[model samples]
Target: MAHETPRHWDRNMRERLRRGEAAALAELYDRFASLAYGIAQRVLDDEAATGAVTREVFGAIWESPERFDPRQGTMRAWIAGQAHQLAVARLRERAAGPAVREQVAAAATAARADYIVTAMPAPLREALELTRFQRQDYRQMAERLGINEDEARRRLRLGLQLLSSAAQYGAESADPTGGRPAPPRELGSR
Candidate 1:
């Protein structure tokens, strides 16, 4: 898939899978296994469950490649969505009382935030990473990214806004939705 366009790659992958090509499935697994594992891990927080979810996600995709519609989104999004849904279902299964349900919701919300940050456009991701990991302010981020302060501020703000939507995303899947409204406002807040 070197230098191949995503649409082309998606189309080719679908065709290959439809033809029952093992190599295609291997390629797809290689490309997305980590992403699937990470999303499942974030939601389930259990090694065995996460591993099971990863295999189930890839197995479902391989069994029904037609379910993946590139028109709706990229293959990456499809895989992530499936992994998230399955993990949430597993979480719901294990949850008992209302308190446990709320905790599950929060875990799902944090997982969604992780997915959002991972999927953010490069510039915004970089800005947020600088602030979070490097402890940089907007001006400092600008200097590090070689962009103006305003651009740095804009990217960070946009990234944060995207992250803040994690709660809403979680609510869509959360049964009795009550959790932190968003990812933590500060590193210390968590």
Candidate 2:
């Protein structure tokens, strides 16, 4: 059989969930549990709390399948959003001071970046990973990937542009400069 598009899968999942099918719930859990757990862990940084958040996300979906509107976004995105919200709420509850609060916000931003990177197209992701992990320039990336320089630069630019949205996730408390992630600190510099 041909692969199903996300829209079809989302619709089927919503119908199955609305009907309260136990197998559907199990399948949903199997599919999204890792993504939900990863998001929660990134934001909460606690094994226990992340596990709780992951359970709560699935429980909420099981209890209220109607809450997920396919018109708004894909099922994966909705699940991710639920996980992020629950984890951030838990983090806020434990945060005591302004410094900790800032860290909480930063954690949320990092989680968003992770999600974006994971969801981006493979070409863009490869371009970004090469640059970030291997410290490769556009020219070098193109040479390594056997692509032209212009294509490499285009992929890198698009990937960075997509990742930049993570900075806007918590803009209310964002620092100056319109919420861009800070450049890496120079070696031996404070």
Candidate 3:
């Protein structure tokens, strides 16, 4: 395909970066900052690790600005590709630790909050509200949530497990910073 980029595609400021321009880099950072961080978050799942990944990615870019070849593609695509690759590498290396658990916890909390307010997918939202908020039983909320009663029960169980996992992550890890490696799941509690 002849790469028809989206209309909102931010213009590459590489031409303006001739003199190792700080402002140009800043603009690039502003443009792709969320993307880089999000990639980091998905992979590392640890606040510190994510930040480190971002820093290293940009820091490397800053050091070797000429590495960006415009003929290949726009700067955003190149940078996102680099960031995503590196972040994924870092994430894959991480132990399934408290960091992962804590990240899951944060996501779960967000989903729960979203389920409360937004006009989410039909039936699931109703089920969540009834079962979670109205304090109704699974069978009753099943009618509201839309899924089969068994499905509703499964969702409830998953939600509770996520919440509990978050609590455990916080209590066990105590630091969102991925400090020490986590023990294996097979090896029950020490």
Candidate 4:
């Protein structure tokens, strides 16, 4: 019997790879690398980090193929989301450090995003959008998301922190003003 390829082979292939097929994983890598790389590069706009994010996405596919539910969106959408999540988390963790130049370098390596990373999970992303990017305070972010201040703080602190570490690895830098500032950043990358 001949198999008629469905509309979403990439996702199907990825879903398969997730289920423990080494060959499928490699095939999925070859199939989605460019697309995934582009997405990661858009958000990160950097080379090394983009590559790392790319590898991580595939690694995730290998680790938890079950997570990619077709009901939520397309394979591309899933790729975009994972890339966004990894990028945001990367930036958040590395947001701290003594080297603005290094951070800039990291930015240089980031993949640009077609849709803003926030689009993946709007409310959570908005909640997680760093003050440096969304520029909203805990209260403002919470208000925007219609959540409570403590939840905002929790998301901003714990969620963002963990997000950062998972995406990359680093502790967020201390706010320049000692306390979190009120200005939202126009641009952000990890």
The best candidate by lDDT is 2
Q: Which stretches of candidate 1 lie over 4 Å from their true place?
A: 97-190
- Report the C-alpha lDDT of model 1 over 1-190, residue by residue, as the tens digit: 3699898889889889989899999999999999999999999999999999999999998899999988888899999999999999989878776777678778988998898787777888899899999899999999988999888888888888888778876675575443434344432121
**lDDT score of residue 189 within candidate 1:** 22
Which of the two, 2 or 4, has more lDDT?
A: 2
Candidate 3 residue lDDT tens string, 5-105: 63223334655565677997787788887888888788777888888878877887778777777767777787778888888877665665767766766
RMSD of each: 18.1, 18.1, 16.0, 17.4
Those runs of model 2 whose alpha carbons end farther than 4 Å from true positions after fitting are 96-190
Q: How accurate is candidate 4 locally (lDDT)?
A: 0.64
Question: What's the candidate order when arranged by decreasing lDDT?
Answer: 2, 1, 4, 3
On the 0 to 100 scale, the lDDT of residue 98 in model 4 is 57
TM-score per prediction, in order, is 0.50, 0.50, 0.42, 0.46
Worst 10 residues of 2 by lDDT: 181-190
- Cα shift from native, residue 107, model 1 (Å): 29
Q: What are the per-residue Cα lDDT tens digits for candidate 4 across 68-161?
A: 7776776767877888889877776566565874564345324222123443344446666646576878888878778899877866664454
- Candidate 1: RMSD to truth: 18.1
Ten contiguous residues with the weakest lDDT in model 4: 166-175
TM-score sort, best first: 2, 1, 4, 3
Give the poorly placed runs of model 4, Cα more than 4 Å off. Answer: 1-15, 98-190
Error of 1 at 98 (Å): 14
